[model samples]
Target: MKNFSDIQIGNTIGPREQFVSKDECRAFAHSSGFAAPRFTDDEGARKEGLPGMILPGNMSLGLLSKFVTDWIGPEGGAQLVRISTTYRVPVQPDHTLVFQGFVTHSVPEERTAEIDVWIENEEAERLVTGTATVRFDK
Candidate 1:
């Protein structure tokens, strides 16, 4: 198990790129019950002046959560007690999505910490930003 305290503030966790495919987007849209044409149809998105098909905001956060969980592992489970995020830009299915996070603050007595999270592209342009509270206890 990795120690959460060892991770420093402003440290980048992952630039792990994930390609959001059309089939994946459609499946997610259906599963999430999101009926927005921007997330479903390429033509609709283009007509709306968007680049292409857009991914759901929650889906991006879901990817972030997965990254956190994987980092924390079994013996060191991080309970995501709270999260605050803003979608700065649309995530196109054709582009690679990067999930990155950093330790912002630590409260050892409370066995909790705050982390700033973001998703960016290869060019390092931030598409989303957020804060997350993680609880570490045995």
Candidate 2:
């Protein structure tokens, strides 16, 4: 686990990659109550003019959140305060998505840090972009 002091502004963390699969998308859609055919059925997605089955936006956001927390670890004493994301393009199954982050700002007095985060596909197209704020306890 990295402590608050270990985090430096402008430092990059992770290019954690995950290959999205159809089954995973289906499960995420089913469990999240987002029963959209585009998220679970390739044919349905094509009918809707999509390339193939796509993952839910929230699922992608969850991946981004996981990337941050995973880097900090449970004992890092960092509490996520806020996060906001914008989906630029759909993420389809079979694509490898890479999650990465940059420490944008830090306030030592508040023991807080702000990070700029994003996810990119194998083709290097950005799928999601966001910012997160985490406060660390002394």
Query: In TM-score terms, which candidate is top?
Result: 2
TM-score of 1: 0.87
Stretches of model 2 off by over 4 angstroms after superposition: none
* C-alpha lDDT (0 to 100) for residue 101 of candidate 1: 81
**Minimal lDDT window, size 10, model 2:** 71-80
Candidates' lDDT values, in order?
0.79, 0.88
Evaluate model 2: give its lDDT.
Answer: 0.88
CA RMSD of each candidate after superposition: 1.9, 1.2
Enumerate clash totals for all models, in the order shown: 0, 0
Pairs that collide, model 2? none
What are the per-residue Cα lDDT tens digits for candidate 2 across 29-72?
99999779899999999999999888899898888888888877
lDDT, residue 127, candidate 2? 88
- For candidate 1, lDDT tens digit of each residue in 12-100? 66767787788788888889998588999999999999988888888877777777776577666568788787999888777787888
Report the number of the highest-lDDT candidate: 2
TM-scores of the candidates in the order shown: 0.87, 0.93
